[model samples]
Target: MTDYRAAVQDMNFLLHDVFQVSQDWATMPELAEMMDADTARAILDEAAKLTETLIAPNARQADEQGISFKDGEVTTPDGYKEQFAQLAQGGWVGVTANPEFGGMGLPKTLSAQYEEMMCAADISFSLYSGLTAGAIMTLDLHASQELKETYLPRMAAGEWTGTMCLTEPHCGTDLGILRTKAEPQADGSFALTGTKIFITGGEHDLVDNIVHLVLAKLPDAPAGTKGISLFLVPKFLVNEDGSLGERNPVVAGSVEHKMGIHASATCVLNFDGAKGWLVGEPNRGLAAMFTMMNYERLGVGIQGLGAAARSYGTALEYALDRRQGRGAKATQEPQAEADPLIVHGDIRRMLLTMKAFVEGGRAFSTYVGQQLDRAKYAATEQDRADAEALVQLLTPVAKAFMTDTGLEATIAGQQILGGHGYVREWGQEQWVRDCRIAQIYEGTNGIQALDLLGRKVAGSRGELLKPLLREMTEFLQADAGQWSAEYQQLADAVKSLTEVTEAVLAQVPSDENIINSVAVEYLNLVGYVVYGYLWLRIARVAEAQDALGEFASSKVKTAKFYFAKLLPRIHSLRPSIEAGSKELFSHELNEF
Candidate 1:
């Protein structure tokens, strides 16, 4: 196991030094006195201990044992139930939930850091509570007052777990083609009938009850997404006195045997006349679900980052211990059998790349967390609008880019381990398998790319881009004197990407295929440029503090490597996005 204490230190650096989350949290009167650095640090320390000591020790075993389903009852690995009880007792599940529902009411910025740590230690175990957090957030926003009073308190208290039921057998992304139906009864409730697939934590023994926020269509509702309505369907319905009542009609038909994260049960849910209460108004379920979907999307991106961090840590330790080739600058000890793998330049390159990405991603996630807080708690309307715009623009970037880099970083870590990486004992292969799902779920990376280009850039004629571009430019200009070369490189890359975005937008209105054809490439271009900007910012901070130690020195070198090697990829995307959509659209149906 890696040193989680060090991870918490790095998190503090990003939260306090890089983004100054405390300053933003303090600005909100509701949050100012409630959350401070000391409280945040204490929470992180406790979380780190729990993750490293309890959760992580069972990750590999859980993966090996997987989940067992016997006669409709799913059983998780041993110790998971106990560890989950500890987690619930510790009040971790409601770290960022509303206080009115028995939650701790911590800021999302602080919770984001802790969430990353939990996922880093054990992503499979993290899912049990992570899904609940997302479900609680959505319910807090969209659920009826009665439902909130009944469900939110227990769910936040970890007495019950939650799952989001969206992806059906027939549809994943295209909700317009969904066939689920909700028929209003004589009473206030509706009878829900649908089959939902890929439902994480859908059925588990970790909690007493499960609350499912399901999306279905009403009989008289319109077609497509407009017809969708959100429902709160619990495993055990709540009585008027807030006690557990009869079982709802929802049940898990079967659990999935997946490529990774086996300890987290993914279920095929069958709702046969399930009694459910409407969450929001009729014909407004998609909007309500978006609240949870957006939250989970960013959470999945953090999942990628967390998995990458764990892989990097394990590989780094192995590199230092494993004996290999001689150092580039040889010493008298050359007489020995061999040198550590860290002495090699190629190995250093791999480690440095992973380090840069992990730190940069930490900064990026914290930045987004701050934006979310500001969007919710900021005093002024303009401040709220600016924060919301940044969140909208960066949510897709955070979701897609972090996971893409995460996969790359994990692969690099595995490669550093060489043949040992392929086997199961070392756990490197598990990291790869676990990280792979981040790209596919929470909307595929391809979907994220399309969203960035179509919605963020071209949707409003680059209205969202103006604020982000201005923010990046101002940060670069502020430190142009010290890190001019790297800053200039990042500026030029941003300028090129901006120009290409404009060009594509100009042509995309006439050709819809352009968005789909070049979405992935465009995403890569923007992701690299954004990371380059982040590297420059971190380098400036290091230079300003005159910190010439290994940490700061590595930051400077990583910035150079990113600018020299990574920034050039942005140029490759320009022509691809500008290729129009003819080639993609020209493919014949029978050609396959």
Candidate 2:
């Protein structure tokens, strides 16, 4: 496994050079002085130490030991309980949480970089804390002041963990069919009864208590999604004196036997008349859950980027160290059995592809993080709205594209190691397995595509597309540099994407099934073009940096590779998106 030092440096580059997040952090008076470059760097260094020394060292062992579920109690692997305690005591859980509730109150952009580092180090271990952060955000935004005061501080301090209970056995994407029932009682509380499957961190021994943000339907509420309401159901009810009371009705029915992320317990939760309190207004649980889901969607994207970084690091090491066939143009005789794998152009191609995608995804994640900050802390309403709109539009793309790239990058990395990559000891195969879930869990990439094409782009008659296109056009027009063939290629790719978007919009509504049929392809097209734009941005920055002269040269070369090898996918998508829905719908259910 790769250490966290390199990951932190990459994160700093994305934050300071690629995104210029300091300026955005300065906008919020609360965060202006607390998150300077020095503080940020120090935070990164500490996180690296904690991740490399404490969390990452146990990654493989935990995966082997897995979480044990016996007699309704979940026991984490050895050392996890203590490490999780240190994680909470260190205040890492509250990096981006509100200050009013005993949190560090850092900006989202900085926290995003931290998240990437953590995920790269050990994704399974990180999920235990990540879910708490997501649940805290939802509670802070929608839960009552009493709930916030009681739970946020404890959650931030790591005394308790939190889980989002939305996916039942029958309902995942279509939350409209969720059967959880919430009946009001005389004491301003409700009894929640339902089973939530695949709930990450739902049952863990790392915390003293677990808080569940459950979605259930209320009696007399409207039907479908509108009838859903969010509730805070704790594992053990807390007494007024901050002591633990009797255990609530919520119990872990069983822990799942998953393909990866074995350390993080994915529980089947049975909320059998669990005592609960509504977080927000009735019939608006989905709206509140969206707040958490959107944040998590972006976090999942970071997971993809982090996994890519790990894959790249390991593969790069192998390529440089492992001896293989001689170079294509070897001028000198080989001294050893063979040459380093890096000598091969094909190997270089794979490495550079991984590098390009990882770096581009990093930049994109930071960009979205900055947008989230602006949405939350901008002084003007219009600025906030604009930032929020961008966040909404790009969230799905970030989730789908980053993970798709992650899976591809990890596979490429594993290929670099050949047969050694498939084994368990090297950890290469584990990266591939752990990363696979990022695409599937956080609203499958297919669903993300549907949301982007069906809801985001065409939702408002291309209103979102117009602003994004204008922004890209302005950026390309502003970079008036000479002797930059890669920049020109990127500009062409952007123009191609614009035309494709317009064509898709024109054909989508006329044939209602077109969007669903080609949503994945359209997403890939947009992803490639957007990444091309990121490569261009990175090249421009590298051009001006003297400290990283050699690195800048590599960036230029990698950007060229991206344009030449990767961006052509955008053109491939045009016909696919225009193919109409017939191909997908052509097969009848009985044909199988």
Candidate 3:
């Protein structure tokens, strides 16, 4: 397996040239105080070196050895402990946590790049720190002052890890059916009694304690999801001096045997009258949990992007170095009797396709991160509200589209290697396996599409989507000197998406199941257009840079491929979405 190299140049291009975070930072005091352009680049460079050298090489071995479960205890593969220690010592877990509580407090736009690098290096390892970061964010946002003082610094310092426990044996998506119960005690705490499954980082030896943010209901509370509340349940109780006390009743019943991410623990945790403190107001836990969910959803999407990026790098290297069939043109390797795989048109197509999606996705992720920054640090309430609206509108697309296409990109990378890709030795197969879960987890791509079409778009009567279209339209109307034709095509795409969104809205009044049936297709249409917008932006920046040289030239070519080849995918999805749910419900229940 080839060593995974982070796309630092592309990251810098998106940060400094495309999104221009430096100027944005100047407006927001929180970000301005953190770092400048050079500082941010140094962080990315350092993260790339750390993950590539220390973590990437150990991924395959860890995946092979996997996690071990014995006597309700879970242990990671060899070398993970030392690697996790390094991650903690570097304060990577709390990169975006509150700086007042011993965190770095960098912007998500910067931390997100580090996330991509870590995931590319090894997703299984990335989850341990990623989940911790998400949990830290949730705690900071919703937890009380005492809880924050007790746990935030320790978690930020990497002395402990965290998990989000929301699933059960009977419930996966519908939290309304969850059977967990929380009983109030005399000590002003709640004793939570429940069994939660599919809890990542639930039980692991990498840290001394696990902070589980769980959801349950009180006895007299209203039924269904409305009654649920969030709890801060620690594995061991904390004393007055902020030291670990007696063990809580929560224990790992068992660890799951999974398809991928073997090095990360997926446990079935049993909380038997576990003493916990309420994090927020009762019966509104789902709202608070979304704080973490939204962040993790984006993180999961980056996981797919990271794996796909690594796949492209590995496949591209193999194509260049490995000798293959003769080219259509005269062979450069006449003495060697065969040409490299790069000479083949199909291989180039595959390689370019991977490049198009990976680079476009990177830019899109950064764009979303910029929105997050605005949502947090923008001066005025209206500015923050507008940014938050965009974040809500595009997050589903980011999670679903990136992962859905991310899986496709990984498969294409695997296909480039043929039989060698099917085997584990090259690590392409692991990427395919690992990337598969991104679409399923983090509120499944299908659910994301429904949220996009049914909730965010139709729920707001198309208001949520208007801001993004306006942004794109403004960009297209601007002076993009040499890229007029490409901008026009993007204009056409935006026009098509606008029409499709309106059509869906018009049909939803009569077609009850319309959104569910065509939701994925609609989301795909939006994704392609969004990527097209970002690609053109990247290409425009690349072309204007006199110093970028070949890097700039490659960006222009990839943007062309995206416009000429991939962006046209929307042409097909548009009609599918327009077809409505009629054909889907045409068949009878017994027809199959």
For lDDT, the strongest prediction is 3
Off by over 4 Å in 1: 1-6, 329-332, 546-549, 586-592
**Residue 507 in candidate 1 has what lDDT?**
82
lDDT of each: 0.86, 0.86, 0.92
Ranking by lDDT: 3, 2, 1
lDDT of 1 by residue, 265-326 (tens): 99999999999999988999888888887778889989999988999999899998888867
Single out the weakest 10-residue window by summed lDDT for candidate 3. Answer: 328-337
Error at 439, model 2, angstroms: 0.8
Q: Write down the RMSD of candidate 1 (Cα, Å).
A: 1.7
TM-scores, each model vs. reference: 0.97, 0.97, 0.99
Residue 312 in candidate 3, Cα distance off native in Å: 0.6
Cα lDDT of candidate 2 equals 0.86
Clashes of each: 0, 0, 0
Task: Give residue 128's lDDT in candidate 2 (0 to 100).
Answer: 88
Between prediction 1 and prediction 3, the one with superior TM-score is 3
Model 3, span 379-430: residue lDDT tens? 8889999999999998999998888878888999899999999999999999
Question: Which has the better lDDT: candidate 1, or candidate 3?
Answer: 3
- Residue 198 in model 3: lDDT: 94
Q: Which portions of model 3 show Cα errors greater than 4 Å? A: 589-592
